[model samples]
Target: MSATFAGPITRSPHPASSASDRIHRLDIRDLDELSPDTTESHGEEGLTMRNQKEIRETSIRSARKLNIRELRALLGRCGMSVSDYDIEYVAALHGADGQPAYGASPHDGCGRPLPGNRGRPLILLSDLALADLETAVVTIYHEIAHHRSYRSVGHAGTEAAAERYGWRMYSEFVRQSA
Candidate 1:
């Protein structure tokens, strides 16, 4: 399936609407053509610096156009119920240990959860300017996975599970979009 972004983008508040339902999916193979220096690494393809920048810009534009309801719906698709949580787009994120990250979740070291939510998780998205659409979306899914893992199994094995969940969600999005 060829992924192509087409038509006028519209915002929908429906929880059933997913990224795959909205954005066109481009074939992963096609990404290489976008940059001459693209290469395969560690069994994964790497985009050139220029291509990365382009993807980031495009992602930012898409994210800015997405309304809060749409963002919430996207999270719902990832199996996260953020109806009570606060989702904020910020300049950047730092890990629980103070290192930068693409996204962070409630009290995970990126930042403190928003006050007054009564313990509902807070999802902090990095500024769109600093992340590609894929990274941003995946980060949201990743954080949600962390929330789920923490609740289900405690913190001992959250990272591996979250990483797997995030990548699986991302792959599905790509495949569905394609």
Candidate 2:
């Protein structure tokens, strides 16, 4: 398959402030830092993926293989109205080339929301949790479930909400993939 990388998402900076229903949580962790290279080595040569940078770059290329439209459509299928900006931001954070340092905690695998940042809507995604298409859809839908919760209630009831809607999100993703 042909793969084209989109440089980086930080090329266009986001506004400092936005509505509660349209903000994105920036997860600065580098998914590229982790190595998943399994390329076979040649005889007597301890040659491997070589450097972590190469491994990370390869990972970024692999993640970029997902179609953006398909990702948006996947979210739409689950009833979440996400903007192109949100998708790009999520993709950037999950992809390579975005600034590293900021990360989503608790939900470190994906992205995280700002603490005490009430009335702010955020979607954080991470390759750690959603490494492939199936998990990607699952993770995005899970965040959307949270968005739905926020829409219904000014703020969501953490424990009950997660438990109630978590599996539904996972199932919906599996269904869509199937």
Candidate 3:
């Protein structure tokens, strides 16, 4: 089946701000700090995939318990901003009339430009309590990338862009964290 990454709802630029200015800004310094050093070893030499997965799962569980500020900091280090948005952790996402789904970005519903901050875009996350830390983290970045791509390229190319950008950023996060 084809995978669809949801895009963000577009909003009109505020009188005092332009669309370019509102686009999510990636912090280079944060990224720099998150980059893994090639000289360092994360003890991957003898671990099997299952062992590595267990370690990652443990890390994710610990991360979920982190406070909002800490969570934001982690995301920030991955070059994502949760500053202007409200994040909702849900059991699972449902389509219109509540159909089962994995995740979605509410802003991606239409191409119409919304009023400046008209509504809090739902960064809908599903099964956070059960998802692997890597999956949860990457999903968040993936959604934010959708917002960024929607702003930059509009709806037509959002999914592809989000996938490209999200995976790249997530990879960097994993490397640096490792």
Candidate 4:
């Protein structure tokens, strides 16, 4: 989806609710208009230093739009054949029923089955779940784990597995690139 914006790029780091997900084109001219909680966290005073650090480090990459080629390299690091799947960024995703939702997946990622792709080994990332970089990485791994788990452990289990697995992949990528 094509959009025009000025200034530092950003969107809410939270999930999109149904009521606010209808806009096809967003006018993003200012960070103040998008994030009211930019300067402070909800309450970081009591958390451990590591926990606080993790929160800060794990923030969505709002300052820059993440590169898709970089993410494809991430998929390659995770062992998915880059050319086999059709991966692209989207502004908002459609519902499961395929209705138009302009910005429904700001903080979510999805993995979908492509049985007709001439023989894919497993499910791949839901092309829709990638509203941002953090969302893309997490969702890609989550979907990979989710589909590979054979529907036994469910979403939460898949999420846990994805964090563990995706972290290793990301860490390895950083190490190798360095």
Candidate 5:
């Protein structure tokens, strides 16, 4: 049960423009900003966990944890292939060190298509969403919408688009249980 604070994610001069799938999307993770001093136990599995700056906090708690592999499969069912993006479980989403203006809302979750990387885009999901499968699914949909729109919230019709896309997916997968 040890907790530590860290820094922020630095953006390179230019984001990667690969040919593969053009990785890009939002990744919602658990809540780390809410629990900064909280401690978690990993026993002997060596599972690392935390929620702070410029760092990615990983957790082994599967209570409702969303599996990345499963996430891709779910996306397939949703009529999208996010193979171009990389999704990871995180406690909080951080902005570029000194670039708060370009930072994202540490709320539900966030998706980024350009973070200066060579591989697929990065999606920072809230690890807290792991507490519920439906929440995770819906969150994915929301972020997927952002990816599809190629823009995070704050733009015109961006948030609406994410909501529509996200709920549609949720209804298709959860409500309908398809």
Candidate 6:
């Protein structure tokens, strides 16, 4: 004798909710914007006001429009891969010593080195700072400037040479590769 198999059927719940069961849905951004506190911390790790400001200032044609994946891919295309180790090293070399201390800045995406002896090395980057692809390249190039300096000398420079050299190297690399 042959036996027939039966499968469990799933059903959707009723579409309507009772007066006592009202529910609300919201995106993180909407929640953030609605909160009284302008800055929100995610557990111990979160973006800071200073970091947000830095991204804002360097914002050129494509600022606050780059995603992290796009930034990573762009760096890979440029032959520079930034891993956790490299990120920490670069952040530290740029003056962000270690995990941020109490009263210290939270995010360190300023494109500039952390303040000497009083900053963190995590260097957080959030969607608010980089929303899509083009800005990722710009942000990565800025970070590369610091990394190259760390590799050559002990740390990244803060003088006019730093910015000049960083932009110069970035331009040269792009032109030659293209």
On TM-score, the candidate that comes out on top is 3
At residue 105, give the lDDT of candidate 3: 55
Candidate 5: tens digits of C-alpha lDDT, residues 60-145: 35465667678778766655556665666665442223211111212112223533143554555665445456556555655555
- Candidates 1 and 3: which is better by lDDT? 3
TM-scores of the candidates in the order shown: 0.47, 0.37, 0.49, 0.37, 0.44, 0.34
Ranking by lDDT: 3, 1, 5, 2, 4, 6
What is the alpha-carbon lDDT for the whole of candidate 6? 0.32
Kindly list the per-residue Cα lDDT of model 4 for residues 1-178, writing each as its tens digit.
1211111212223222233322122222211122322232212111000001112334433456555677787656644434443444455343323332222111112222333234542323333334365555544443343233323221112223333434443443344344
User: What's the distance in Å from true for residue 18, model 4?
Assistant: 42
| Best model number under lDDT | 3
Candidate 5: RMSD over Cα atoms? Answer: 15.0
- Residue 120 displacement (Å), model 5: 2.1
Please, what are the lDDT tens digits per residue for candidate 1 over residues 1-178?
A: 0111111112222233345432222223222222322122101111001011122334445334344457667656655445655666666544323333455554333223333244566666666413454555555555665454334433312333344445555665555445
The per-residue C-alpha lDDT of model 2 at residue 133 equals 63
Clashes of each: 6, 4, 6, 3, 16, 6
Better structure of 1 and 2 per lDDT = 1
lDDT accuracy of residue 78 in candidate 4: 47
Q: How close is candidate 4 to the true structure, as a TM-score?
A: 0.37
Residue 164's C-alpha lDDT in candidate 5? 44
Candidate 2's TM-score = 0.37
Pick out the ten consecutive residues of candidate 1 with the lowest summed lDDT: 42-51
Question: Over the stretch 88-162, how does candidate 6's per-residue lDDT look in tens digits?
Answer: 212211112222111112223332334323342333343432544432333343444334333344333222222
**What does candidate 6 score in Cα RMSD to the true structure?**
22.8
User: For candidate 3, what is the TM-score?
Assistant: 0.49
Which rank order by TM-score, best down to worst?
3, 1, 5, 4, 2, 6
Model 6 stretches astray by more than 4 angstroms = 1-64, 84-135, 147-152
lDDT of 2 by residue, 1-178 (tens): 0111222212122222223222223112211212222232111211100011122453443454555457777767755445522532333232222233111212111223322223244445544324456445444444444444333432222322232233444454444445
